[model samples]
Target: MRGVGIEVNEEKVGRTMEVDEKSVSGTRFCLLLSPDRMRGSLCLRLERFRPRLGSLPGRRQRVCAQRRSPRARRETSPARWRLKRMSPSPAVVVLALLLAQHPSADTLRVPLDYTSIQEAIVAADDGDTVLVWPGTYNERVDFLGKAVAVVGREGAQVTVIDGGGSGPVVTFGSAEPPGARLEGFTVMNGNYNVQLRGGGILCSAGATPVLIHNIVSDNVANYSGGGIACLGSSPFIIANTIVRNRARPFGAIGDGLGGGIACDGGAPTIVANVIEENIAGGTGLSGGGGIACYGGSHPRIDNNAIRHNVAWSTYGLAWGGGVFCTDASHPNITGNSLLENHVQSQTVEEGGAIYCFDSSSPLIRENAIRGHTSGSGGAVHTSNGSEPTLVLNNIEGNDPYGLVNDEPGVTLCAVNNWWGAVSGPYHPETNPGGDGDPVSDGVAFAPWLASAERLVFVRGWPEACRVRQGGDLRVELAVFNRMPGFQRFWFVTSVDLPGGASFGPLAGPTPLMLLPDGMMSGILGHAIPPDAPTGLWTYHASIGIPPHDTLDHAQFDFEVTAAVQRLLRSRSLDCLFPSP
Candidate 1:
């Protein structure tokens, strides 16, 4: 026979619990394995209450227009019918009473004359719904501690929620546990639109929220967090298009950051969102034209198109044109396309596409960056006491300048990066510039060009690129085809031998061909070492031609991957918050 024992200990402030249980086989369960941790009270409150209805008497249902007598009930028993008619309609009275209390939860159809959504909220309950037709509403709404859904009707078109408020018009505050969700809405306008304070729509104060299939755009912020400000929370800002959000005046006197989404301290998952054309302006130190991070916030920025945004010298000294991270804020940025972001300010000196500074390091990987420029890193810049940045699996186009690491011990390592139109060993032997030009200053002009013969040299070389211990190994190439006409080529791979470590016969002479229109392909081939080394070993790759080809020498540098490097050196997987 099994026996169970329970004990309750009361404390001054709260209650404590203890439990012991024995199985039929005479095994005793420890107090730590008690259900106290698993047992929690679930409080479910109805946003709106509805009353149930009962049957009516035939005497009460009198005959009218096409009438004869009230028939059966009138003929059967008049006295009983009169008694039944005198009885109160409990259902209607109860329903009216319930409706008076929590008005939001009861389901009510949208009135025909209800032109504004704000009016509907004022009349609804927590679980109530408002099915709006295709039209635009220019008003601000505040969901004060209610959980309601406002959805569009079938075939609804051009339905817009234009907030006329000064700052974040549509607000959602949940009084429940945590992790609320909001789906299917388009919001626009206001100085800084769609501001989510404590727990905005689809956001919870203590738990993660889900926001999906929405469009938030064309908003302005005088300080930080231009379009949608996600603060002290982890929410899914997924499958939404956030565009044209701007942080104006450059935050000359304030902590101006995150033009698109300013994540102060919390890490939120921003996945598969089209974040484009957002601006962070400053003559000096304004960051994250599209997205920025500060105050030890690291987010996972993945699978989004962050393109055509500008962060430049409104007054000069603009920091991040595309994305910026400072103050030990590390973000994981991967699988995004950062294209054609311009940082052309008179005082701009750092990164054009990305700027990492002040001991903050992020992981950047598998991103396509093209046509971005700054005085230092035309693609990426790390300055003023920053640390190791990993650059991997990126097609870095012509920006005249690549990476700038000015401090002595600040290591800037890049491998397997397709330096567009630049060739060589990837670094300067003595004092070579970004393009192996040998004369690159932190300011003035960036010399991002290289010849196949004048390979840019990495000072520490293979030390900067390596795989993790007991992990899978990969060899990625960012080969650039420089020839004018149709050209055919391949990659010859090799690995550096440290002490006794060695690898051999790298998949003999694969084939790659490119046309004149500058369309690039072929980043294929998998190198997983079944028995990889425990420490650093550089995998060197070179482009070559088959013995029967005409062109003798034509090849460029490829991208690299160091396991879990910081953000600035990353070529893929950049974002904020937790994602699956």
Candidate 2:
């Protein structure tokens, strides 16, 4: 008797097998195997077999096997193997011949098997993943048109890809498909002067790669897109923090722009990113400190926090501190928080939050655009035949006018927006008489919203007050809701007291059911410790409805002083006298 062992890891296959032999003729035997009805080991018995003749010397033998499932029958090919049923229900079949095949994908590890990322990629085949360890790699890597995933084994916080301040950090060409992905790395310090595109990442010639959960920061480009540049490619850029990059000067003119991200002639999805503190357009028509979309590129800019970006031009006009769109590029700008973006220029500048020129009709909706500072259009500037649809946005607290139109003939359709008030607060630039009334000069505003969908305004009394040591301090706040519907809100109040003294919650995350246009007043009291140092303490109040969406934030400062004898004596006297 002879035996063989085979191990199967799949749940559908049996675990063990046994075989027994019996001789029928000289140098010939018959082999038989018995398979259990369900979930047991496969048994094999050989009765007769021929070795030298290369065929069975007697009649042809049949082997019985049971089908595992209905899906298993389809997995067995009919051309190489034939099955004849021995029974009808729960069929046990006799197989003449069978062949099985198995295939596996590979995970190429970096530094363990290969010394560098590019080496592993070169040795890898299609559908392979290169796993990088947590370490700083100072090299410029290119995808080389391979469908693979280059991912960090750790997270983005530790896995670093430093570019050494030259060339593109990562490049993807037309041969790369959307399956090629770059994830979980800090791509920084790339400096490309001659190419002038994509200091951090470059996707060109219809290459669609997935870039997610990365930090692309502190890169420099001479022409455009210090952080990332896309030329005729649609990349999925999601959930990244792109900050502090610089786009220096245009190559000639009308080219260098988009300090954070630049898109040309492709539709990319940029969602849920934090793009802040980028500088674009140092000279020669610089624009789009946060993002620039040109050459009929349609990008979806949604649910991102774009703040603290600056755009300026020395020779040509500067547009869009937060975002600049030109050349018939239609972008859907929605559900974003644009705050504190500034624009500066010697020539004409426009759009602290957004600038649209050359007939780019973008749908600007449901965004909170506040605290933008610029020469014109503190919230939005539309000029040169660009007509954007502004609807359902909270356009408030922008310096120098909410919306600006540079041309008198092209009118802007701004409807159903809250401009810090219910009516009559918008200042259009084209108004010839310049009287802050509701008038249209190439701008149409009205049929305005009666109330905002979500509004919270907070203020504190006694903005600057001196409280003695071990004294009781009280901070009061008035929160207003202007939503048209009745909803429940949660309020939180905190303080940054001096000397590391903690402030306990006096009231809230307390729920309050507020009606439309209703107001709620609450007080937070703190007992100053005797050992607390004398300094300025900050008090903050925030209101929101669940899951970390803060609708309003207010902060004020107050001074803490040592105990005064005279003030304590006056307080004691007032308590004893008891005002009647």
Q: Write the per-residue lDDT of candidate 1 for residues 1-580, one digit (tens) a residue.
A: 1111111112111112221211101111111101111111111111000001112222121110111124423544331111012111211222232233224344444445465777876776554555555567677666555445455442112556776546664564343212233444566774742323211122334334455446777777765667666555555566567778776653344434567776665676776566778877654557888887776777777656576777766555677777888888888876565666667666555677788888777877655555677665556777776653444434445365655665565445554444554542234543343442121233222232242221111000110122332222222122322222334454234444444343432322333333211222111123334344344343444444444322222212222233342212111112112142
Question: Candidate 1 versus the native: TM-score?
Answer: 0.53
TM-scores of all predicted structures: 0.53, 0.60
Question: Model 2 — which ten-residue stretch has the worst lDDT?
Answer: 93-102
C-alpha RMSD in Å of predicted model 2 compared with the true structure: 32.5
Q: How many backbone clashes does candidate 2 have?
A: 9
Q: Which tens-of-lDDT digit does each residue in 1-580 have in candidate 2?
A: 1111111113233112121212312111111111111111111111111122224345342222222334544554331112222121100010000000001336778889888888888887655667788899888889988766687767566888999987889899755775577877899999897855888999998887778668999998877888999989878786678999988864565445899999988988786567889989765677889999998998988767687898988767778999999999999987676777888888777788898999888999877777778775546888787888888887777777778777667777887777667554445453333322232356676666766646444434421144666655554454543333344555555566676454533233433343333333332345566776778776666666554666665565666666552121011111111111
- Please list the residue runs of candidate 2 whose C-alpha ends up more than 4 Å from where it truly belongs after superposition: 1-103, 250-255, 427-440, 455-580
Residue-pair clash count for candidate 1: 69
Local distance difference test scores for all models: 0.47, 0.64
